[model samples]
Target: AAAVAGMRDNNAILSSRDWARRDVLMQTKCAPLPREEGRPAPRPLNLVQAATVASHAWPPQSTCETLGLTALCDTVRSVAVNREVIAAVSNKNIFHMLQLYVNGIKAAGIKNSMVVALDDETAAWLKVRDVANYVKVLRSRTGDTGNHATSGLKFKVLIDFLSVGCSV
Candidate 1:
């Protein structure tokens, strides 16, 4: 009851229609506007200005490149299945677990599985093995050492996949 009272005081409650209208307004306000012909590119926003921007700009442009989201989307499209199976692996476990994992998926006749390689070496290894078709190398900001290090990255990976319209 106290929580509900607090939320009401904060104006946090709204009807579904009100929430839908708010969403439309936010999308309209935050969307990048088209530049008029011959107009100079807008100056880059300073730190303060950027910080003030809406959260809707999320999965920022740099994140897309760093995660190789476009490539992942392409790989997902190549699979005919409605859902995709993703295996996130770093070079540390490539030899120890990748083959066994891939074999299991193959034995099950799953055609939509793909690997999200956490390092360049893993990507290279996949290419050399001629099984790089469904692999997408995700560039990590900090070097990922093992499963523990990469575990925290799952949410970000899932967000990027969602942004690209892929279902895992």
Candidate 2:
């Protein structure tokens, strides 16, 4: 497909030897600042510290809350065609959103599609673009909005859709 070819071409350019050398040169020129007088020197984590951190649970068992189950059911029902809903899960990455809108959704002429925004910014972006009807903002119960935490909330959204009698 044309998209696949374009992606391959972009990857080839990014992984070229010249780009690698330039990346290394930029990193060397932008090295971190020296330690301040009273501040401890920066160092990699010790084995014990690394192990302790790694052993802890990540993204903290969180739940997602939307406007309400009734609202979700309404949105799903409005977008569904024969009980099938097309859903796209996204965070605040606008570039990817544009690509999906243009190449995937728009190109396919999909009317049964909706976007599940994992954060407030993404929800606002979708609304501003006149896609508010297709956007659902899923907020984390634990109040963590980091990328990993938001990603972990996607399963809950999918389950919600299925519970509303719509297949995504």
> How many angstroms is residue 67 displaced in model 1 relative to the true structure, after the best TM-score fit?
9.6
Model 2: ten consecutive residues of lowest lDDT:
55-64
Reference-based TM-score of each model: 0.50, 0.48
lDDT of 1 by residue, 1-168 (tens): 222212333235676665433333344443334555687998743332133433444325455576667566555556524334455444546466877776655555556667766666677776666453444345445765666666766666676576644456
Please, what are the lDDT tens digits per residue for candidate 2 over residues 1-168?
122212333235453444433443344443333444687766643331122322222111121133246656556556665556677677775546455673556444566777777667777777776552335566677877666777777788876765444567
Deviating ranges (above 4 Å) for candidate 1: 1-68, 132-144
Candidate 1: C-alpha RMSD after superposition: 15.8
Angstrom error of the Cα, residue 164, model 2: value is 1.1
User: What TM-score, to 2 decimals, does candidate 2 have?
Assistant: 0.48
Collision pairs in model 2: none
Query: Model 1: clashing residue pairs?
Result: none
